[model samples]
Target: DQQVKQNSPSLSVQEGRISILNCDYTNSMFDYFLWYKKYPAEGPTFLISISSIKDKNEDGRFTVFLNKSAKHLSLHIVPSQPGDSAVYFCAAQFGGNFGNEKLTFGTGTRLTIIP
Candidate 1:
């Protein structure tokens, strides 16, 4: 899990609206990126992931987009629901010769689903 800096500490969204969270990094050597959702006392639950070779990855209501040129990544939750409220984390690592031996996490984003 690769963690750097998360500019926005918290976000609020209507229960039925969309939630968009973004993360930025300075490193450009990573080959894979993953997103995790964390509840109060439970461990983070893996949400989605994308490889450097792909610009976007989607699963159900979650979608992750990567822009290598900008060294930026963003997560999109469509028709956000109250159950989606949680702390979201982003992790990245290299995959080939070095393997996924290293994982760094950036600061987390708090997504709030307003009612």
Candidate 2:
């Protein structure tokens, strides 16, 4: 069964604006969450991550917010740039240490930054 979902298959954002990508999960057992960005013909690269204990995490232009009560999470990119365009994936892990956790990934969302 598909436990994670990204409802929006694609999103477009103007450069220099904020881009919000959303995801939802059906599995409440998941305790750790992560975001990855993939470029064409390249592997998905880790972006940001948040633990189940925290509501939000930020790094540079990227931020991830988790709403445990609703089983929802989002990635926010501020001042989006053309280089930020990519396919974004949201992942969850349950019951393991960070280094060894098995991650479940959502269907990716394609984000395009319009210049």
Give candidate 2's error at residue 113 in angstroms. Answer: 0.4
lDDT of 2 by residue, 1-115 (tens): 9899999999999999999999999988898899999999999999999999999999999999999999999999998999999999999989666665878999999999999
- Flag regions of model 1 displaced more than 4 Å: 1-3
- TM-scores for all candidates: the values are 0.92, 0.95
Q: Which ranges in model 2 have alpha carbons more than 4 Å from their true place?
A: 97-100
Q: What is candidate 1's lDDT per residue for 15-101, written digit by digit as tens? A: 888899998877787888888899999998888989999999989889999999989999999989999999998888788885566
RMSD of each: 2.0, 1.6
Model 2 poorest ten-residue lDDT run = 94-103
Alpha carbon RMSD to native, model 1: 2.0
